[model samples]
Target: MFGDGEHDDGPRVHQQRSEGPGGQSAQQHQTHLDSIFMLLEENIVTFVKNELKKIQTVLTSDYPECLESQREDEEVLDGEDEEQRSSREAFLNISLHFLRSMKQEELAERLQSSKSI
Candidate 1:
């Protein structure tokens, strides 16, 4: 329905889009699986760092004058507020559930063991 050298960049292009839920392509699904798998293998150093930043902000904002002068040796979980702890726990469980849904029993078990600790 087009000239020899022309292309259809309208409905035809849209029709070729992924049928996967949330409009994710096959490659996207593959990348998601790979990412979760890597997270399982890497054991959450990144997650801990992120939690540290959040905890630091909350502590400094609440009692800056006291904490800012202390220079204390602190850990990420040392000042974890209830909400932050809950968020971290929820993420672990969500990841575990996703792994299980993908039939990754081994990874799910690993996550479960970690979560218990």
Candidate 2:
């Protein structure tokens, strides 16, 4: 079917029929399979998009919490002393690390769910 110069933008299947008491033509069976595959693909795409939206929502909601916590930590380290600067840097690093871990976990869960599908 490749390079047939037909410019058909559809699924292609081999046309080989099986003879049986109640059987469908090879073309008919292939068409049915193609339809089923196309439907399945669309469903998968929709599911992934939905999952991504959920992830986005979760991230958006979590953002304010992150910012608030950072602000609180900074308030606690109000002094410009060396110890306070060091503590602030440490807190920022830890916060960044925690956020990265949370994002990684979310992505891993998403991938696991997609694999299940």
Candidate 3:
């Protein structure tokens, strides 16, 4: 903690940076938390774009399956830390309505049923 209405996130953030390459700031790390959904959504869009060229009917269920096999930091989600996995699940839960609002009802439903998506 600090004065002047400022605060410190403390040593975990500091330790994360220590484990990585030099000079990576805490805000750089915060980006991973903030961009999880956006990054996942971008990956979905890429899959859809590729699938469109190969076939007509793209099954929404395929996304979550494909997504489960995807990786971060050169490691698959199966190897992900608890914090990251929990963050991802929480984000998916929060984004379900957004998924439906975007006309992705089937995708939303599939993710809702899956523990990891």
Candidate 4:
């Protein structure tokens, strides 16, 4: 009886249930999986938003000073090297993209698309 594909060393409840006629149906299993995926997506979105908020706070509060300090350091090297400057600019662009992706409208659109699937 335990030879069924769904039956194995899975969680004790699932393993036991899979051996019985009262086991969850495939539709129920798929729904449960979908809900789990939705919950994980929401958690990831929350984490990204919180981290972006922290970064935005830091940037707003200290960005100018940070830039000034970077400029001073760059002057010592006779202005920033081309490669280093480009790398910094690329990092900034990626950060901006993440921030935009977390915006309410963008998130709402993504949620809508996910729900339709």
TM-score winner = 2
- In order, candidate lDDTs are 0.62, 0.54, 0.56, 0.54
In angstroms, the error of model 4 at 61 is: 1.8
Q: Rank the candidates by lDDT, best first.
A: 1, 3, 2, 4
Distance from true position, residue 49, model 1, in Å? 11
For candidate 4, the 10 contiguous residues with the lowest summed lDDT are: 108-117
RMSD of 3: 15.1
| TM-scores of all candidate predictions against the true structure | 0.35, 0.39, 0.34, 0.35
Worst 10 residues of 1 by lDDT: 53-62
TM-score of 4: 0.35
Ranked by TM-score from best down, the candidates are 2, 4, 1, 3
Q: Give the residue spans of candidate 4 off by over 4 A.
A: 1-23, 63-117
> What's the TM for model 2?
0.39
Candidate 4 backbone collisions, by pair: none
In Å, residue 73's CA in model 2 sits off its true spot by: 31
Model 4: lDDT of residue 7? 61
CA RMSD of all predictions: 13.9, 19.7, 15.1, 15.5
* Candidate 4 per-residue lDDT over residues 8-91, each given as its tens digit: 565687444332234776677778889999999998678557545433444443456555644444464455578755654454
Clash count of each predicted structure: 0, 0, 0, 0
Give the C-alpha miss distance for residue 51 in model 2, angstroms. 0.7
Task: Return the number of clashes found in candidate 2.
Answer: 0
